[model samples]
Target: MIDSDILCDLILANKHKCKGGEVADYIPGLKNANRESFGVCLIDSNREVHCAGDYEEKFTIQSISKPLVLMLAILDNGEDFVFSKIGMEPTGDAFNSIQKLETSNLRKPFNPMINAGAIAVSSMISGASAEEKFNRVLDFIRKISENPTLDYDEEIYLGEKETGNRNRSMAYFMKNDGVIEGDVEEALDVYFRQCSIRVSAQDLARIGLFLANNGVTSSGERVVSEHTTRIVKSLMVTCGMYDGSGEFAVRVGIPAKSGVGGGILSLVPGRMGIGVYGPALDPKGNSIGGYAILEDLSKILSLSIF
Candidate 1:
């Protein structure tokens, strides 16, 4: 028996604790977000939803899409094949850092949670063209979230594509190393589009709920295999918060993935799924307010998997 009212009160009590962080400005469009905005949504095993603050606010999914896409890639092409292109280890460097890739003998991205590895995963998604591949991913996301109208934010997608020189370099490097097969631009296009998918806290909570149930929907249909869900959750626990993963695991004690757009999707294994949003980001690009809220909620609810 989870207490929805207590959760709402907790969010209101700690919303101001996130004032120290700044919004992500590197993306240009992400800079337009309201720094004070914060939202949270939680869905329990019984399908009950608890929401607080700006739960209805919409934002881009950003790097949080990595885990979902990683699961999709593994579903399309088994884990063994996907792991061959990207290592499962976390890189202590920044998520977009290419220096690590350049310096490593393996020349592979450290994990699917980072930019290089995600681009490699994007290339593996089955499709004849970039459009087809993107549509497939979009459809998958929509189905999992149970939101048929979910779609990408075109403005954010175009902005990212126009100002994505760093990502372009990563894609080309992976192509040269044979880690990514096919057109670099096409793969990048799919990656950017997936990152640009817009969702409210409710939508993200629904997606998290799907993962929490081991890829099963409330209707009991499995969208992804249990094995794939386990791998994705493990990656989220180990590398989902970029370089801040260790601290998050220590503080929150649950599997979570955060995006630069101030969204985090987290779950308490078989208990519930949580979605959080706050445009104010810590230096590591995680939602400051969102993190605080989750920390408080996890403590109160004893949601730690460990």
Candidate 2:
């Protein structure tokens, strides 16, 4: 049996570790987060929830939205069609680096976990216009997380839109390469809105739980297919942490996706889903304190997939 008391103690013990990292400030709105905030939530297959610290506090979902978006795209367009647009390999470059696309002859984004591929996948979402596509994404997330009230943070969306020159460059490059279809701005709008979806740690945990159970809810309703969930988890293990994926795999030994907003959606396949939030981030944009706490929990609870 998992020890909820120990998990809470671990959170409290590791909360002070936030001093070692800084919050993501590139997206003007993300910089407004409290640097000291930390939270965690864990839900097992039985739907029992264990939480600690500020798990109730809401934050932007950020890049953690990538895997979810990828699943949606695969469901909409099928895997073969989607993979034809983006490569499955992990890029050693930063998530937003445009140089990788320039250096690669294929011009396809490395993986959906990165910004370029995510933008491409967003374009593939079934819709006639940007608004329709974004609404589809919003509905999917709400269904997966079981949170009817979840919505985008318009401030963050506009902030990302205003300061998204790099993303714009990537979209245009992909358009030139024929990797992305439709209007670049429209695709970017869907991407930005999806990333800006606001959720608390508990919401993420619930989403993770769905993934943990192979795309099924606690009530036994199937969301995504088992094949889709398997692919998503495999991608998370290989590329979920951006360039730091290998290190995360070595340390945590579970599939997880981290966001610039300091949220992590992790799962122990068939066991539990975990959500972590620490506004402070490491150089690679992962939650520093949150990572440490997960390491502790994985070790103490033998949660590693390996």
Candidate 3:
């Protein structure tokens, strides 16, 4: 096992060096975050947490919610039905880019982690009302975090709503393809709401623990099937970092996710779940410091399954 103290020191030591990177200023609400802020937490399969720096600080889940939402859609509808609406390939384009939509005759988006694909996944999550879908999404995060206080950041949600014209456009485009049957506005509402779910590094690590442990909660509770967990983790490894997915897989060598808010959640199956926060981002919209931290730990601890 990797010593908790070693990982703690690694994060603390490297944080100051990464402060010069850009934060996620594109999202209006994320612009207010401390660009120098950094945190890391490691959770075991038993849900035990070891953390350093600003691990208790709340931040939006951001794109990290994409995989779990995709998982939920599978639970709501079978995988075959879900993939028929969204392709599983990783694109080299930017997350919000519309190039693929325009250049290709393909009807659906490439994958769920991208903006267009997320909108498609948003429609598949079973629920009649926006509130119902939002609640179910929150409930799943809550169960994984084991934190009842987990709630949406309303300010973030509103900011995303105000600036989510592109997302709305994406939903509408998907709707035109018969990919989304319900109201476009309602689906976008759920997407933004899920993106706004607030969680701390500790909470995020706990959630990661479930994915690391094959859909079983730390307490041995089965939240999803083993097969479902496998599918979810595969997507995380292949498509979690927008256009940088392939590079992240080669560099980090673990199932991981990057959020626009400068967070990365990573896991080593049956070994450890990690949550990291560094508001300074790389060109790919991932936290520069967070990825470095995880890569170093993966090497030092030999945690890479590959």
Candidate 4:
């Protein structure tokens, strides 16, 4: 087992040097975050957890929740049905950009990890109302985290709603293409609600553990299909980090997701899951400190899947 103390120390030592990556500013609430904030939490295969920095603090999961939602959509609607609304290819476009919709004839959201795809994926959940859909997403997240307390942050949701024009625009496009069903406004509402779900490092690490153990927690409860989880993990490895995914896979070599809220949920299947938070971001909207720590950990511990 990797020494928890050493991993935590490496994070702290590197924390100061990772100060000035891009901070998410377009969102009013996110703009106020402290760039110096940092945290890390690691959950081993046996479910033992280690923590460091601001690991105890909670933050919005943001895009990190996309895969979980995608899993729900897949389980609820089946792979063929969900895949119809999302492609496997990387968009190489900005996550919130509507350019793909305007230009591509395929009309699937390109991939489930992106904002556009996530909105479409969320729309596909088996619920009649936005609130019901929101509850299902929360349920899925809670099951994965094995934490009944996991929940949405309405403050963040409302703020995201106020500033999510890009998402709204994409949802509208998806609806028009007959890709996303139901009302666009309602779908966007549910989608934003999930992205704003609050998660501490422990919560995130547990969720990663769920993924690491093939959608089953250490307690032997199955939260999602092994097939669904495998497919989700495959997508995470290929595209979870958005445009930086390829480089990340080459370097960090873990199935992971990054979020604008300075959170990352990463995992090594059958071994461990880790969560990190650092408000400072890189050009890709991933946490600068979080990404660095995972990169360092992956290399130093020889944990890369590749």
Candidate 5:
């Protein structure tokens, strides 16, 4: 792990990037975030932890939840069923863009990291009811993070539900195309709730550590299969940063997922898991200060897998 003093200095060095960025305003509940807020947590393969800034501040998981839900969906329905509805290729369009869905010959979303594909994947989680389905997703997250009290923010969930016109359009479109099989609202509900789940940067780091450890808990219990972890990390590399994934790879060179809420869940496979939060975002919805911090840390530690 990086030295604590060095970690703190890294955060202070990049904290100024927040001034040039914007907090996500499309979602009403996320608009009030402190624009200057920044934090990071890193947990290495030895179970050592290091943190700086406001690492314990809670925020919604947002799109960062996509890969986690994809894991559960795959566990419930075989990879054949899940991937049949969602393609593995990366998209060049914005994460929420609807253009490619119409252009693709199969009508499937380009990949699970985007909203359209995540919605499709969310519908595949098995349960007797919508509530049961959401509980299962929540349970999976809690188990993986080893945090039993994990929960979502109702205000964020309701706000997302109310303002999610674009997402609704995608869901209805997928429903019409048979990409989604059940009630559209039910599927959207699960997606919304998952996105609204709240966690601190430390919590996100712990989740990333779980992935870094190949889905095995610190106690040696396996929460996800090795094959599934590999697929998830690959997807993170290719699609996790929305259309910015390629640029992020060239710059930071780690598998990561970013949410519009300004949280990033990243891992250096077998080495460490990193969680970053900086509510100020660039045009692409990634945390500006957080990105700077990661880039600096990657260069300093030579953490890039490439």
Candidate 6:
């Protein structure tokens, strides 16, 4: 087990940084989050959990759901089919930017971590109805995290649907370019619902540990193939932090995905998984306090993959 004292010190060290950052204001429900909240949970390969502060506080998964959805899309389809629709490279633009979609010669989003690419991938999930498709993704998240009660936040889902004009614009653009097929609204629903799924820092750590184990659950069940996990983790390393991914890699040097809800899911191959939540965000949307905690944790623990 990781020392609780270290985790506590990390929280105290970075708590003041929350004052310098802003909570996500665009999402009406997200704006209600407590800006001073900060927490971290770490799970090792041995299934040991180390946590501090408000680690049990539940929040929407947000963009951190992208990597998991991409995994399911690949499992349902194949790499060729999925990558044919979404490029693997990172975009320097914002996660919701439409400029790249209009400019790309291939007419595909730069990567699955972006809103456009995630919507394209959500369209590819196999199911007769949107509900079936969403349940499939939700079940996958539950199994991997060992959290049977995991569910989406209705308020968060409504907020996303109400203020998701920008996302709708991206989906419509992709549909017009033939990058996504059949019922664009259905695809957007799946994407929005996935983002609205509620999880605590501990839940995120459990999911991260699943990735660290190459898609295997704590009980030794393989939820996804090793090949699929590799692709998802690669995307997390390259595109997970929006435009701030490169800097995160340089500083923390781990495979991590951050959500607008102020959560970061990170993993060290064959070692441990970490989750941090700090609602106050920098201009680029990453949690300022959460980022500081991870940076210090990585240095102190020598957790960098490099």
Off by over 4 Å in 4: none
lDDT of 6 at 209: 94
**Local distance difference test, each candidate:** 0.91, 0.92, 0.84, 0.86, 0.93, 0.92
Sequence-dependent TM-score of model 3: 0.97
lDDT of 3 by residue, 1-306 (tens): 656798679877788756768878766889999988888999876556788888888899999999889888888989999999898888888888776875777778988889888878888878879999889988888887778788998999998999998888878877887878888898899999899998877777887888888888756799889898898888888988777888888888899988988788889988878999888888888888888888888878887778
**Whole-structure CA lDDT of model 4:** 0.86
- TM-score of every prediction relative to native: 0.98, 0.98, 0.97, 0.97, 0.99, 0.98
**1-306, model 4: which lDDT tens digit per residue?**
777797678787778855778678886677877888888889998778888888878788899989999888888888999897789888887777678777787767789888888898988988889999899889888878888988888888999999898888888877888988788888899988998888887788888989999989777988778888889989999888889999999989999998998899999999999988898998878888888899899988887998
Pairs clashing within candidate 5: none
Q: List, residue by residue over 187-259, the lDDT tens digit for candidate 5.
A: 9999999999998899899999999988998889998899999999999999999899999999999999999
- Residue runs of model 1 more than 4 Å from their true location after superposition: none
Clashing pairs in 1: none
| Candidate with better TM-score, 2 vs 4 | 2
Worst 10 residues of 5 by lDDT: 1-10
Q: Residue 278 of model 5: what lDDT?
A: 96
Question: Which regions of candidate 3 are displaced past 4 Å?
Answer: none
Question: Model 4: what TM-score?
Answer: 0.97
- Candidate order, lDDT descending: 5, 6, 2, 1, 4, 3
